[model samples]
Target: MTDVAIIDYGMGNLRSVAKAIEHVAEGRAVTVTADPAVVRAAGRVVFPGQGAMPDCMRELDARGLRRAVLDAAHEKPFLGICIGQQMLFAHSAEGDVPGLGILPGEVVRFDDARMVAADGSRLKVPHMGWNEVWQAGPHPLWEGIEDGARFYFVHSYYVAPQEAGLTAAHTDYGVRFTSAVARANIFAAQFHPEKSAAAGLRLLSNFIRWAP
Candidate 1:
């Protein structure tokens, strides 16, 4: 059986993500781990993270699993969620922290403009709620999920990949931002699947069944 490793780097909503993955794993071996050896040996890797960039990076490095994550990203089907996805970029405006640089881009904060809807009410920062995600490209991870599907989001910042083609899906707040991305063996999302309900579950299912 192919083993799925949900990296426990001490950040992310590990329990929720692990439970969600386990719920859909069917017969696969799913492990919530911080061990480099376990991560290296897994057939697939799920990288989920929350909280600030600096702390997340600190924990990942403190645990000495940075190299393991990089290796997994290169050698296996890797799924990066939220801060896990943000950390894949070259840099982040959040605390000016540097990222893994696996994907060419920088993470940026939503500008401090006083955004207002046509109804004239102030739009909130940390964009927490269900928002529509428009597909920017096609990938196996998006299977069965329709374009313009609503996914749950909770963040004050978003990724801005240098390569426009890297964006797999986008969402609009005051501005349009990349909500999901894909390349080679990596597919990542800025939303929390465990909190996203049905469409989120479907996306997780697709990830488990994804061959590439």
Candidate 2:
């Protein structure tokens, strides 16, 4: 079987994600591909992306990866990171752009007004740093990871699912937001697990072995 396929649509540097998966995939064949066929044929799919929502959507379609992504999300174990996670929703406030609608939700930016720490310090918009992630519940992908482990984040926007049950984990910066989501065979994270160090590696390893 094609063990893992990391979708490449030219959004961001996908090499880190590829290397991280390679570290955990054992001898599993990991392919970084832009081909729709490879993505559809893979046993597991990791959709990692960054940048603005509108551009991401356009690039996805332009590269002819739209249908393949949707298919993998429905048929196999799927993992989405950063904008990859946001694109799974119905819409995004980033540019009033529509998404794949695989999940019922919208991606919204962190409020500028609420960008303050408890001591009244200014919090940055990108939220670029390590933040504590509170696990919403147990899942196979979270195996060997603590509930409040810190993960690296580098984005200004976060997703708001229509259903609360879809939240796999949450984190607080300006306000609490869905940092990770899971339903059926899909699990997505707003944080960049590839850059999150040991805890991140553990999560990736779990995903490699996750059968659901």
Each candidate: RMSD: 1.2, 0.7
Q: Tell me each candidate's TM-score.
A: 0.96, 0.99
Model 2 lDDT tens row, 1-212:
57899999999999999999999989999999999999988999999998898999999999999999999999999999999999999999999989999999999989999899999999988899999999999999999999999999999999999999999999999799999999999999999999999999999999999988
Q: What would the per-residue lDDT of candidate 1 be over residues 59-160, giving only the tens digit for each residue?
A: 999999999999999999999999999999999999899999999999999876755656777788888999999998678888889899999999998999
Query: What ranges in model 1 sit over 4 Å off?
Result: none
Which lDDT value does model 1 have at 31? 94
| Per-candidate clash tally | 0, 0
Off by over 4 Å in 2: none
